[model samples]
Target: MIPKYRKQFNKEFSDEKYSQLKGILAKKGGIEPTFRISESPIFLTKEFESKLIDASESIISQIKTLPAEILQKAIPDNCRVPNDTDKPHFFTIDFGICRSENGAIEPQLIELQAFPSLYAFQKVYEETYCEVYPFLSEIRNPMSHETFKNHLKELIVGDENPENVILLEIFPEKQKTAIDFSLTEKLLGIKTVCLTKVKKEGLKLYYENDEKHTEIKRIYNRVIFDELDNIPDLKTEFDFREEVDVKWITHPNWFFKISKFLLPLLKHQFVPKSYFLHEFPEHESLENFVLKPLFSFAGSGVNLNPTIEITSAIKDKENYILQRKVNYEPLFEDINREFSKAEIRLLYIWRENDEYPILLENLGRMTKAAMVNVDFNKKDAIWIGSSNAFFG
Candidate 1:
């Protein structure tokens, strides 16, 4: 985080501008963002942007070498399917990083989700960032909102009609993050329906609209199998892997393809030394690393400072990983106000037409806690969760 920009923004901060931001988000159905939207966009020198891009390339390269078999083994026991066929298609990676103890910057793989993230909403936020704050003229946000929409259309629909594709999720209306799914519907003109609502007529999937049925040729899947176990009564006629005929935006295998399991395999100065807990060499001094459940979402079941007894309690050590912790420097300024520590989630979208993934969006998460999770975040914290601010 750049201190000069933070200081300047805090000096010129106005509640009226923040109110306008709230109005913009309200129109888009976004929760009012709590973090400060700077008067001027934070400028990233080419050197800094290159470092971020290099870090991403390093991670992607490491992911390429990870064996599919290893990922199959890492699936949580509660969510395991007989074979890979039962898995949801595709995954998006979120990287969390800060300047490491060694003074060089490196990333820590934070959250991995099988579900769709706030893709479309992020685009809207980007535009709001530009509109509400006009001072950001020198810095580029790196991601373009329009390009993101086009990329999703290309990735999900290809040459097919958008009507045939469905943005699939489970009990979508009841999901906490349904606002994002709604945004996707508005942007792509695709229907967002629940798994149970999906009907099977021969091999194709269909959903009813205004008492009429429409075929589902492709699915932008948002269901997480782990969450399904929580509600057993909801029945679906078809299994995702066995009988579904639609194409997947992210082929289910990639969820396992790009995950925390690959963190240890990546060779980068930014990546902490990681090892499968089961294969980790026995050491009395195990306090140096943090233990994380391989497939858990958010920061669930992560022991930042683990005790030997807690480490010993791990039933399937292979299902867990130990990563060296990176201290997040609280770098944002609020003019003697509490500083919200932040992590930048660089979002990339891979399209069929493109040879490589496109850097589409940059998502920022802020918290007044020691860590960025809900548990660690301070109460009444102004900025938390998904956010985008102008960067010239």
Candidate 2:
């Protein structure tokens, strides 16, 4: 967070400008972002941006070397490969970085999900930000929202018909991120259907709509197999791992491939040393680390500023990890309030023809509390969990 930009923006800020922002967002149907949208977009320095990219590359390389067996153990039986074609499911790894004890900035591995992120809404949010606040001449978007949208379309649809590809989720309406599914449906022209609604006849999967059943050729999976396994009554005929007619956007195995468990395996100045709680080495001090669950969303089971008693209380040591805590240097300096730490989520999409991951859009999260998760955020805090203005 740069202080100069904040001062200037705050000095020029007016009630009229805020009104205009709210009106534009409302018109674009972004009044309710599935996740929280902050009051303002954050501006980043070029130096910080480069470090973020380098840290991401470092983690991705570590993900490449992970053994297939490590990943196989995490996949559910329904999604596990039988004897061949043991490909992973489609998913992305999100990292929250902060400056560590050494003065260098490193990434704190956050949740690794086996489901689609807020890909569609992020594109829309960026576009609407630029359109609504065009007067901010110094601020420029790093990636165009249109390009991100097209990139997602290409990745999800490719040469196949959009009708054949359904963005699959479980009781999508009941999901906390249902807004993202709704946005994906509006932009990609793909149906967002529940898993229970899918009809499996023979080796093919189809969904009936308006008295007609359409064949499913590809699945942009958003179901978390771990969560799905908890619900007993939900019935679906086909198993995700078994041979089926549809292809996965991200095969299930990649979820385990790029997880928090891989953090200790990566070698980088920006990553903190992480290890399974059960395998923790005897140390003189345990206060330097934080405890996190292997698979949880939105920082559900992370214990920041951990103590020895806290570590001992963990019943499932195998499912927990102890990661060194990184001090988040509050970067945004303009708001006249308490200091808030932030994490930038660089959204990347790999299309069909693309060999490398394309950095599409970004979402920034700010927290006035001690941590970045919703648990630590204050009710009236400024700029927590919102899209940011990454100056190029």
Candidate 3:
């Protein structure tokens, strides 16, 4: 973090200014986000940003070298989808800023996903910050708004008509990320439709638009297969497992293949030591390790401190992973002298012809709690929540 920008921004920050920021976000996004918006954006030095990029590339290179059989084993039998793409179109890797054994600051890998994230809203969020704090515009972002928009449009819409492309999810309006869906439509001229709304006729899928059946050509999938698999009574006209006419942007199988299930296989300085519960070596202490469900989303079913008894009681040992806990440095100092830890997610996109996924933007989360998740965050906390990073 840059001390000069942090000090200047904190000096000018006010309750009234934060209120105006919220108002403008609601106006621009067409709805208030259900999650907390942080009071400040972090300023990162160029050297730190380069380290983040290097760590991500190292992990991705390892992933590319993995045997096809290994990737096939990563996906569960019940979760596989037909016609998966050979490569993922999007990648989001999270890194916690921490101090190394030598006391030098560095980034540690937290998790990585081959799924699309707030590609539309994050750009708008950063631009809105510039509008509120005019001095922030002087500091360049990781990627320009124009270039980000162009890449996002190419990935989601491709050469297909915008009308035929839909952002697919289950009960999207009821989800916490509904604000992103609304902004995606406004930015790309595409529609956001619920999973239950898709109508299937033989091999093709369609959704109603203005009381007429509109054929679906592409799907920007946001549905979590684990969540969908758990809903026993849920009904849908088309199943993701079936062979459908629409093209998937990233393909659903990549989610399982590139998630925490693959973390143990990656060998990188930035990546923490991880192992499947069933394959954990004998005599390794569990006190410094955290238990995680292999395919769970958003920090769900994570045990911060695990004991041998807790790990032994599980019936499905293969479904969980024991990861070394990361020591998050309390980097940001607030006016009250309280400190908050931060993690940055590097957002990448791999085009159809690219050699590998390229980092384009970043999303940051700050918290005073043990995890960066909202469930662990204190309600009255300041300068803590969802934020963006400005790299100089």
Candidate 4:
């Protein structure tokens, strides 16, 4: 974080300005986000921004080199979909701020998800920030309006018709991430249909749109195997592996293959020490480790400061990972009292047959609690919520 921008932003920040931002977001995004919106965006110096990119590239380099057999081992057989895409179309790399042994600020890998995130909403969020803080226009945004819109269209629809490509999610209107779904539909002209509404006849999938059944050509998937496996009532006519005549924008297998499953295999300095619970050596201690369910989403089954008894009680050690807990440096101090820790998620996109994924944007989370999740943020904190980044 840059101190000068923080000071200037905080001095200029007011309750009215925040309210205006909130109203503009709800109007422009076409839906109010269920999550918190931070009062201030993280201002990044060129030096720190370079460090974040270098750290991300280092981890991605390792991910790119993983053997095919090992990658196959990461996805559960039950969750594998037909017609694997061979690579992820979208991925996000998360990093937490930490202090090196020399006390200098450093970025440590927190987690990675080989799936699409708030792609559409991030563009709106960035634009809203610039509107409120006009001076921010001088900063280099990770993605411009044209850059985001063009890349998203190419990935989701390409040469195909937008109506034939759906942003697939379950009960999308009720989900917390519905804002992104709505924004995606707005920007790309794609439909956001609920899983239950996808009518499957023979081997083709269709969704009723404006009284006509629209054929599905491709799916920009937002559904997760973890959710589908857990929620029994969330049934659909077509299973993900039913050999349906539709292309998967991002293959589901990558969700499990490149997630926490790969963390244990990575040996990067930025990546914390991680190991499969079942394969951890006897010399390793559980006191400093956190237990994470291999396939859970949104921090569902992560047990921070886990004990040996807790680790032993896990029925399937193979479905869990033990990662050494990395200490977060409280990097942002509010104008008066609240303190915050932050994490950055590097968003990337890779089209079919592309050489590699391109970094499209960056998302930041600021929280005044133990974890970066909005659920963990204390309500009284000023800068505890979601934010964007501006690089000088």
> In candidate 1, how many Å is residue 131 off?
1.4
Judge candidate 2 at residue 244 and give its lDDT: 72
Q: What is the lDDT of candidate 4?
A: 0.85
Q: Which candidate's TM-score is highest?
A: 3
Off by over 4 Å in 1: 30-46, 67-91, 104-115, 142-144, 353-355, 389-392
For each of the candidates, the C-alpha root-mean-square deviation to the true structure, in angstroms, is 3.5, 3.0, 1.1, 1.3
User: What 10-residue stretch in candidate 4 is worst by lDDT?
Assistant: 226-235
Cα lDDT of model 4 by residue, 1-392, tens digit? 68777777788889999998888989977889898999888776788778888878878788888788888988777787888767899989998877777887878888999999897887788889889988778885745688789998998898898989999998888888888898888899999988899999998899998899899989999998667877766667989867888888888888988899888988777788998999988998888788888888777878988888888888889989999888788777677755688888888998778877888888889887777887788898888888888877
Model 2's TM-score against the true structure: 0.87
Put down candidate 1 lDDT per residue, 146-204, tens digits, no spaces: 76677778777777887888888888777666767777888888888888988898877
What value does the lDDT take at residue 67 in candidate 3?
A: 86
Question: What value of lDDT does candidate 2 attain over all alpha carbons?
Answer: 0.67
Model 4 residue 30 CA deviation (Å) reads: 1.6
Write one digit per residue (lDDT tens) for candidate 3, span 295-315: 899999999998889999998
- TM-score for every candidate vs. truth? 0.86, 0.87, 0.98, 0.97
